[model samples]
Target chain A: QQQVKQSPQSLIVQKGGISIINCAYENTAFDYFPWYQQFPGKGPALLIAIRPDVSEKKEGRFTISFNKSAKQFSLHIMDSQPGDSATYFCAASHRSNDYKLSFGAGTTVTVRA
Target chain B: GAGVSQSPSNKVTEKGKDVELRCDPISGHTALYWYRQSLGQGLEFLIYFQGNSAPDKSGLPSDRFSAERTGGSVSTLTIQRTQQEDSAVYLCASTLWGGEAFFGQGTRLTVV
Candidate 1:
């Protein structure tokens, strides 16, 4: 079963605008939620993450808004740039468990110039 | 290698042949993980090893897939009797205990 589900398999946003990607999880035991950004022919890189203890986390231009009760989280890019065009994956893991991350189907984001 | 390193970035193997992929974790990183990326599907967890603990193989797709970690640093994934459906990019990641993981350029495996 897919533990995590992401919406908008692909997204296109204008430069200098906001870009958002949303994800939901079925496993309530997950405590850590992280987003990864991947470019073509490259590995996924950690973008932003949030714990169940916080409702929102902001890291510069990247922000993760997590709703613990809803088991949903979203990534928002402020002032999206062409350079930010890439694939984004949302993942979840439990800190005390095997630490294996369950990932979403991934969203391909395009920032139009 | 300064980062997580994977050997044989691309491998083209015949169906029914056996193949082995290798991964070298970052220095001082105690946690190592393997994941597979396929078309449309996202990263699928394959296995994980943390320090000296027993490895987790629950995510393995079938009995044909196996992995082992030696000296708590390097790992090898072996597939027996390759199939075309096995084609995918295998990714390796490592991290300090409870820290964010760093990934390596994946090994693209194509079975013909």
Candidate 2:
């Protein structure tokens, strides 16, 4: 069973526009949601994360909007740029443990300049 | 400080052979994790080690896949009797307090 599901296998957005990626989880035990950005031939890097207590968390131009009741979370990138073109992965884990992340199938995003 | 480092960045082996992939986590980090990524697939958890305690091996795909951490610093993942289906990019990550994980460049394994 896929504990987390992500939408839009691929997305194309114009530069300076908003880019959104959504993820849903079936495990209520999950409390930490994190998004990772991966470029070709490199490892995934942590982008932004949110906890269940917060409905929204923003850092610079990146934001994570979470809905506990809906068991869903989304990543919003403001002023998307061509440099933002990469694969994004959404993952979730519990806080009590060592935070073993369960990942979703990645979404490839292309920000056209 | 340097981030996580994985050795043998790329390995190509014939079927039925054995291969060992190594990871050096960040200094002073107590948590280490291993994950595998296949083409067009999500990251699949393989194992985790915390300090000197017992590791979480539930995610290991089979007995052919095993890992060991020595001195709570470095780890090695061994794959025995490798098969074509075993080809994938193996990733290693480390965290200070299990919050945000820093990943290595990953080792690409190709089995023919």
For candidate 2, write residues A52-111 as lDDT tens digits: 999999999899999999999999999999999999999999966579999999999999
Error of 1 at A7 (Å): 0.9
Q: Residue A92 of candidate 2: its Cα lDDT?
A: 98
Per-residue error at B9 for model 1, in Å? 0.9
- How does residue B26 of candidate 1 score in lDDT? 96
Cα RMSD of all models vs. native, in order, equals 1.0, 0.9
Report how far residue A3 has shifted in candidate 1, in Å.
0.6
**Residue A14, model 2, lDDT:** 100
Off by over 4 Å in 2: none
Best by the DockQ measure = 2
Pairing residues by index, what is the TM-score of model 2?
0.98
Chain A vs. true chain A, TM-score per model, equals 0.97, 0.96
Where in model 1 is the C-alpha error above 4 Å?
none
What interface RMSD does candidate 1 have?
0.8
